[model samples]
Structures are given as structure tokens and as C-alpha cells.
Target: MTGSFLPYGRHVVDDDDISAVAEVLRGDWLTTGPTVEKFEASLAERVGARFAVACSSGTAGLHMATAVAGLSPGDRAVVPPMTFLATANAVRYQGGDVVFSDVDPQTGLLNIDGVQDIVDRARNGIRAVLPVHLAGQTVDMPSLARLAKKAGFVVIEDACHALGTEYLDGNEVVSVGSCRHSTMAVFSFHPVKTIAMGEGGAVTTNDPDVYRKLLEFRNHGMTREANQFQNRDMALDSDAEPNPWYYEMPSIGFNYRASDIHCALAHSQLKKLNSFIARRRELAARYDEQLQYLSPILLPPLRIEGCNPAWHLYAVRIDFKASGMTRKQVMVRLREAGIGSQVHYIPVHLQPYYRRLYGESSLPGATAYYAATLSLPLFPSMSDGDVGRVVDTLAHCLGMN
Candidate 1:
């Protein structure tokens, strides 16, 4: 673990996970089947959600959630500038506009003050607000929920970075996907995420209508239930009875359904979610303690009031301006020493496509934050020695030694 190249993030799959996938493959069903439902049920229960809809990727999950939130053409959703493009792209996927909101430069949190300013300025056209839990740090959902309520827009939590994350409601802890604040909490099961399902994601909601729409949208908008059908008059259905094979497609939808093979691994991983997060927190604490003294690198924010993070990525802002060296130079030095690092984002509004569409808009806080942020290697599988090695090498790169 000391000598091997450390990645910014990685999945931990034990024998149990392998056996689960193998058992599922050996079964009669491989795609949508019992395993998928079991995974969904397990996810829903774990996240405190009333329903969980499995989907192809986090992007697809966000798309479905946005659609459920009424993010259609000519509407707009306010999103922070500092996040993966998928957060805004999902809004565009529904043909809705994305209005950029700035973030807190130090913590990378979507500034609630900035959000309120955007909402107060815009009299109308904003249909939803997406607050991303960047780097596993849960946003202040309670306050954001209040803002959405006042603004008359739906709230959808882009919780891809936050799975085991939770927040205290005075004393009672609320899970991230409980939808206790937002309309729906979306999650990702990518290999690099807190959970690994090869390629999968899910949407968790308490609203039955949103849950129903999520299910229908993921399955090509086709429903087999006769009661939900629009055009009931058909040879397959009659007044007294219905055909077993009859199905209906009322609206356009995508094939965003995740396969059972993926869900098998996800369910297996879900069993160890708490432990995985525990180890990740341990590693992150180790990094924070060791790297705090280094001048060139600002350690990640270890705590937020009322929130408990899942420790997805240990993103530290390198003081490149103070160090008189480029972030690229520090990253190269770390890579040469077998340590991996990454930039969490480059401000979605500045992306090539977004730039073209928005015609060169700027959010100063997100821009300044992006200039210094770098994610150091932090994963559940990393040992204490590995953590020390990373800190030592990073210090050396910054001339702290």
C-alpha cells in the first residue's frame, strides 16, 4: 500500500461482493429482476426513503429527478458553479436552463447567501434548485429547503458524493436520501463513489408521484398495469378483464434502467456502508492532522456544524499563489512519487459547452476556488502508513520539509 500508486478514490470489493455478483449471474435473471428490487428496497430502508428507483448512472438519476421536479423547456434551475458538469447537464437534458450560483471559496459549499440573492433577483422562470453535496460534504439542506419553499421552486439534492452522509435536526439524525429536505436525493454507485455497482445510480424520494414517474421514466415510459394506462381500448384489455402481457407507453422516456448484475454488487456493498465510511473518515482525519502544518496546501474542512460527511474525497486547496508554483507542478511531483491527485471540478459554467451557451459568464468565487483546489488520494482501503506517505510526499512537493 505504501509503494503502490494511490488514487484519489477507489472501490473496495471483498469476497462477499464477488460471490453476490456471481450468484446473481448464475441465476435465471440478469437484468431487471429480484436482485434489483432487493437492492432498491435495501437502499430505500438504509437511506430512510419511502421509495428508491435504480437507474443507469447518476446523470440519469438526476435527469429523472429534475423531470419530476418540473424542470422542462423554458424553465430554469439554479445550481452552484462548483460541481461535476452532470449536475447542470441533467437540467439541460430536460431542455431547461441552468443559472449559475457561486460557492464559498474555502469550503466549496454552494453559498446559501448567493443562492438567496439569485432567487430574490429572479422574479420568475426558476423551477428548481439543485444543491450538490460536493466531496461528500452535505449542504445545509434545512436552510435550502426553506429557501426553495419561499422561492416557490422544487429542491432536488444532487447527493452523488454523499451516501452515508447525515445531518442533525436539532438532535435526530436525518439520512441524506431521506428526502427530509429536498424533493428527491439522487445517488451514484460509480466505482469511484462511496458505493460500487460498476455503473449505477438511484433516486430516493418520499413523494409517491415522483417515485412513480422515476420508475416509468427509467423503463422507457412503459407500464404493464392496466389501471395506469391512457388508451384503455385495445384487444389486450376489456372492461371486465386485462391481458397479462398488455403494456402502455404514455410519454417519451429513456432506457435508463440499471441491470441486476450491477444491483447485486450495490446491495453487497450497502452491507458495509457504515464500515467503509468509518475507514474513510479515519484516513481523512489522518490526512488532516498531518497536512495541517503545511503552508502550501490548505487542509480540507474536517467538520460542518450539524452535518456528518461520508468522506468521499479529501479535497484540499493548494496555495499555489503562496507557494510560487503551479498546481500542475505539485501534482506532477506527487505522481512521480506514486501519489495520485485530482481537481474536483472546473466550474460547470466555464465548461466548453456551457461557455458557448452562456456566452462567457463568470462566478468569481467558484473561479477562484477552482484555481487552487486539488483532491488528494483518500480511500477506505488506504492504510495509516499510506496516509502518512501521501502527506509526507505532498509536503515535500510543497517544500515544507
Candidate 2:
């Protein structure tokens, strides 16, 4: 590789971002302090949610959501195959069975029809449906929510890639994290995501009970609030004054709390989310314009009306048979040319563990999408020239002018 390597995604950190973290480091409490609450409040307000709980990672956030949704053994949750492992694993963490649903073969998005089929077949024990907003393109949440309401299942959105995405609710523009349709929505702040916090995540919800439950679940099921305490004697002194060190573990929970350092960095990064999304959109348009003429290498799937994607991944579908090159070979060639690419996911059901657990099941949509999808470099900091270079190199590797 002669030129600088271009990764599929990267974080953009400014001096101010460093300064925010530095300020936190200098503060009194580093783990659970005012900065943590401030960060949570900022995220909740940004997404128009009543509450937000910050956690250590996206997986942790998903686990917490599943816990709050009351998933247990014998309870089944619908999970689409075309998502990161964490999306499905979260359900398993709560001792729940996963019913793998298919996605749109073109868009790699969860198909509402596929979910409907699952619900129709299993009328009972369906506790939740997790719809992942893959590649920052939103799922048809309105339709999914209606289905959940009718089927008596909760809807939790895996919106890790869709921090800045928006869609329409009637004539109103609704943000992805607003939880207007779903019961809860989760986001990630990994370096490769829309924002970077080293490792951080948040879940947003409008339901006060769910919000309180999420908070309790994020911190070892411990509650500091005396009102929620089950044991009054231990939580209070003779004068009935709350004991400062007293806390109650009402339910088993994990230590998924996000630190002030991570939250501070994420809070700073959140301020630039709009601009970051705008730049990513600009880069996506450039890819579309330039790659249109290359045959057998299709652009990203067409979005439906009212879907304004955040463009986390500019994944194009290449018909490997027609292109006369395997996906692996193309990736090797691109790497030699200093351009990076990656596959968004393999079907979660096809995983060996899942196959062993659920047995072999056909999901043609997810299978087809996985076979053709290849995510090219896409991030806010890449320049127009970088886009041109990547396209030129990809075209050359594909033997197209």
C-alpha cells in the first residue's frame, strides 16, 4: 500500500474533545458523578426521550433493555439475522429464546413481513421484538410498533448505527432515538460509530418504569433511592435519616455503568453529531454518483420514503459471479491499493452456536444480503478526494473503468 490506509470507519477527535475528558479527569468523581448524569440528560433531551441510561457498551445497553423488557426462560424474542452478534446475544443473556427473522435482501433491514410471519406462527410466549437499524438506515418502526402492540410484545430498537437518522410519523419528523414507536431504543458510541467514547452506550425510553428499571439494571440492580428500598431498617438510622452507604439490590444486575471519562468524551462528541452526519451524507452522495456506472457492483439499497439515513455504512452489493472475482479477492486488492472494506454481518442464525441451538433453518433474505454486501470506507473526516481515490481503486480492482 503506497498511500495512507483508509479504514471503513474512524473517529474524529478535536482539541475540545480532549479538553472535555481532561476536565472530567480533574473532577472529584470519575465513575458515577454529575458528569454522568449530565451526559445522560443531554442524550435524553437530544432524542426527546424522558430518560436515558448510559452504559459501558452497546451490548450492555441491549442486555439492560432485554432485562427491562422482562425476558425470561420460555419467553421468545424476534431477532433479525442481519445484525451484529450482540443484537441476538442480548436476548440469550436474559435466558430467552431467539426467533430469528429475515431482512430485506436488498437493504439488509428487518422485513416487517418476516416479523409478521414469526408472530403469526408463535401466537404466545413472544415477549419482545428487536429491530436493528442497520447501517444507520431505519427500519419501518411504525409498522413494527403496530405489530408489537397487536401481538402483545414489546419493541426495543437496536439503533446503534442510527444516532442522527430520522423518519416520518404522519407529517411529523421523528428522530430514531425518540422511542415514539418502540418502547426503548439503544445507541453506541464506539469509535467506528457516529460518535466515539472509547466504549459507551445509552438506552432511551419514555416509560418512567422502564427508565427506572434500566437505571437499576445498569448498576447491579442496586437502588440508592430510599423510596424503592425493600428494607427500611438497614437503609435508615434510628432518626429515619437515610444511611449514606446503604443500598438495596432488588434484582440481580450487572455493572454496566458508563464512566464519567467515557461520558464526558461522548458528551463532547454528541455536540458535533449533526455535522458528522452531514459530512457522512455528503460522502455517500459522492459514492453514489461515482459508482453508478460500474456494472455488477450495485450501490446501496434504495431507501423508502420518509427514511433519512445517517449513512453509517456505504455498503454496496457486488454480484461476485458476474464480477469474476470473489469478495475476498476484491478485499485483498483494495487493501493492496490502501482502501479498506468490511462485511456488515453474517446471518446470526447461521452462526454455529445458533445452528446448534435452533437447528438449520432457511432465511433466504438474510442469506442473500450477506452474500453480496460489502461495506466500503465511510466516515465524516474523509475528504472528497479520498472518496474519488477509493472509487477509482475499487473500480480498478473490479476490472471496470
Best by TM-score: 2
Position 152, candidate 2: lDDT: 90
lDDT of 1 by residue, 268-370 (tens): 9999999999998898888888887884356566478888899888888777988877899999989989899999898888888988988888688888788
* Candidate 1, run of 10 with poorest lDDT: 231-240
Off by over 4 Å in 2: none
Name the runs in model 1 displaced over 4 angstroms: 235-239
Looking at model 2, the pairs that clash are none
The most accurate candidate by lDDT is 2
lDDT of 2 by residue, 1-401 (tens): 75799999999999999999999899897997888899899999888888899999999999999999999988999999999999999999999999998889989899999889888899575899999999989889988888888989999999999998999988999999899999999999999999999999999999999999999999999999988988998889999989999999999999999999999999999999999999999999999888888854656556667999898898899888888899999999999889899998988998999999999989999989999999999999899999999988988888887
lDDT of 2: 0.92
TM-score of 2: 0.98
Tell me the RMSD of model 2 versus the true structure: 1.0
